[model samples]
Target: MVRVLAFLFLVTAALALDPLPPERIQALAAYSNAHGGHALLIRQNGKTLHESYSNGHTQNEPHRIYSGTKAFWCLTAFAAEKDGLFKLDDHVADTITEWQSDQRRSKITIRQLLDFTSGLEPLFGLHQNDFKDRAAAALKAPLVGTTGKSFIYGPASLQVYHELLKRKLREKEQTPIRYLERKVLGPLDLGPQRYLPDPKGTPLLAAGFMQTALQWSELGSWLLKHEEIVSAFKPGNVNRAFGFGIWNNHAAESKSAREVDVEDTLDKKWHAQSWGNACLCRSAPADLIACLGSYGQRLYIVPSQKLVIVRLAKDSKPNDAQMLRLLFANTR
Candidate 1:
């Protein structure tokens, strides 16, 4: 009788010790702020953590999510796939039938475009051009490397992929943006669609996605729960997750713009790779916390603990993770 009681007590204690609650999420937010940006953490199935800082305001304001737009693009593309609009391996060069004559683009594939392995030379850095000029340049751009040799990591690849996506949808009389509204954003109750276009009036898929941090946070939460979406990022998975545009936080190849210079911070696992617009994302402190606590804002996902941490800012420097650690410490 005594042994059984002791065993039951041990199990009960273990369950009670699990570290998941609103308070812990809040601590992550405070810690994020300490890292350098104003922060917030939220829990919706799991915890979401978000941090933002600028101009004496953090919440109740929307900020641009620079590269985070990539996250949005990933979702939209998958939605297109789910609807059988196109296969993941469909060739972008062939899909955009109008570009068939372009020899430089012939070898490119959809997967290459999503993974930043497209060989297309850089076109965005040139002075922004009118739609006609941008289209012409995009069509004729030379290859810097063969398709799929390495990761060049730029917006033009996504932009081209966006064009391909638009073409596939347009054939069905569906606009890419509208499809997103009906599938990804609408169900989540997200709105105030804010996106920018190039001089040629093309939705800038590589960047240009603009929304409040709250909306982005909501989108992130959707991503956390959707296995179909998350499955796209896992290795050896049918999604061929690494090759897809989706953010794969687990792979060794998965790396972010911010990396630790110090050896001490290397093991924290606090450092993870995520892709989002670095300059355009803006959100309230609470919203940031909520988004991050749920989805981990790209790098960290403590599902068992139901925690996430996110950092957003303009001119974000490399030491940002340290600032996040400080925010957590101060919360205590």
Candidate 2:
């Protein structure tokens, strides 16, 4: 009986997840504040471990997440697949019949578009709220690289995806945004957003979302429970660090892995960008994955630790590798 009790105690202790020490948490907050961060929220082991606000910001104010919006929209694709709408491997040209004539565009799959490997031009103009009829512009965007071989991160592929999803959901008399609200947002308890739609009513899929730290953390927390979204973490052929609107640190395990400043590199022209074996932070756990947006907005998840962190800011971006290194520093 004594031996059995000892074994049970060991198992329980091993399963328990302790909170990070106060000093480490304080350091992380200080790091965030130094980089213009307005809000910081952290959750671990199914509990709220830390929460703070700076820059005269309050918890009630929503901050623009910019590209972090992609992560939420990408969830709609997985949810659609679950609803028997369409598979990720399905060709986008199947729904956007206008592209059937283009040899390169016709062969592009939904996965390729979501993974930013569809070879579409990075049509950043669509990000502007006044750029009316974004879907039309995306359909006419030319292929600038080899399909499935280039990682062109921009609004064009996502706009194409929006058009495709819009057509597929038409039979049910549903819009893609509504489908997303019903399938993804509703479940996470995230209500309506600004969406930053063009005059023709197409939301900017690449950027434009305003969310508070607590609100964005909800997505990261929900991510841990849904096994179906595993596809979101799988890397594409060209960009090993990114897939389905989120970036992963899995490459940190490799000896040759290089920590790249994601925002700065993404700003480079596609031909100039080099994304091979990129790591967010070499010192952080390999399981660390993040939803990053312009101006230092970040929602980071370390599944192995049951951890979720949200940082919101504007006009200034922090170093991802440095912030993540601070988060996990000295924590084994």
Candidate 3:
């Protein structure tokens, strides 16, 4: 009996220690504070390891996740595919119809749109507060390049996808947001969560999702359990480091992996020569996938480590590689 009790005591003691050491946590806190981080939450092996909120922020408040919103739609697309809505390889022109006349535009595939290789012009104006009929605006935007060539990261491509998805659901008389809520968020219990909509009542798939750190972590957990859906995180050919709506670290050692600063990409320079071609963290596990947004909102899932981390900030600079290095310093 004594021996059994001793074993249990040791296990409890081990569990009591923070996964990250005190000094490391201090360093992270200082780094976060210096960079406008409001909340940071980490979970490992299905247990809460650490949670911190600052600058008058609390765990209950929902903060805008910005482009982190894209991952949800990406996962929803997987669900939509399973439900026979459309295939990833389906050409956008087949459904958009308007694109059929333009040879380059007709070549755009559903996969290419989410992968940011659709060659559509990256229009930031679709995200403006007063912009009405964002989907119409996106559909009307001309293709600036050839499909399957370059990674053009912006709201226009996703908004165009919104229109495509809208057309797909037209027969069923269901909206994209309603389909997403029913197919994805409802199963995950992530709604009653807020999604900002445009004047045409289309959910802004490119940005404007608000959820608390814990709520976002739930999404990471859900992704970890759904392997088929997680396959969307695989590195794409055009940009070796990006997948559907997330950044991948799987190709950190690949010769084709191009390094671009995450902070610089958010400055609305969607047409820049260098974008959408970098690992989130070189030192993190190769299976690490991240949903990053403007202003440092991050949802990181490390399946190999059985870990999920959510960080919410106002407009902090990205130091993902450094932060992951600290997080994994002692872990094997």
Candidate achieving the largest TM-score: 2
Tens-place lDDT per residue, model 2, 148-202, is 9999999999999999999998999999889888988899898888788888888
Shift in Å, residue 41, candidate 2: 0.5
lDDT of 3 by residue, 160-278 (tens): 88888888998999988888889878877877555667776776778888899999999888887776777766545777777788887875555665445676755645556554447
| Deviation from native of the Cα of residue 235 in model 1, angstroms | 7.6
Tell me how many clashing residue pairs each candidate has: 39, 0, 0
Per-residue error at 167 for model 2, in Å?
0.5
lDDT of each: 0.51, 0.87, 0.79
State TM-scores per candidate: 0.68, 0.94, 0.88
Among residues 3 or more apart in sequence or in different chains, the pairs in candidate 3 whose N, CA or C atoms overlap within 3 Å are none
Q: Return the number of clashes found in candidate 2.
A: 0
Q: Between 2 and 3, whose TM-score is larger?
A: 2
Of 1 and 2, the candidate ranking higher by TM-score: 2
Return the lDDT, model 2, position 230: 55
Using lDDT as the yardstick, the better of models 1 and 2 is 2
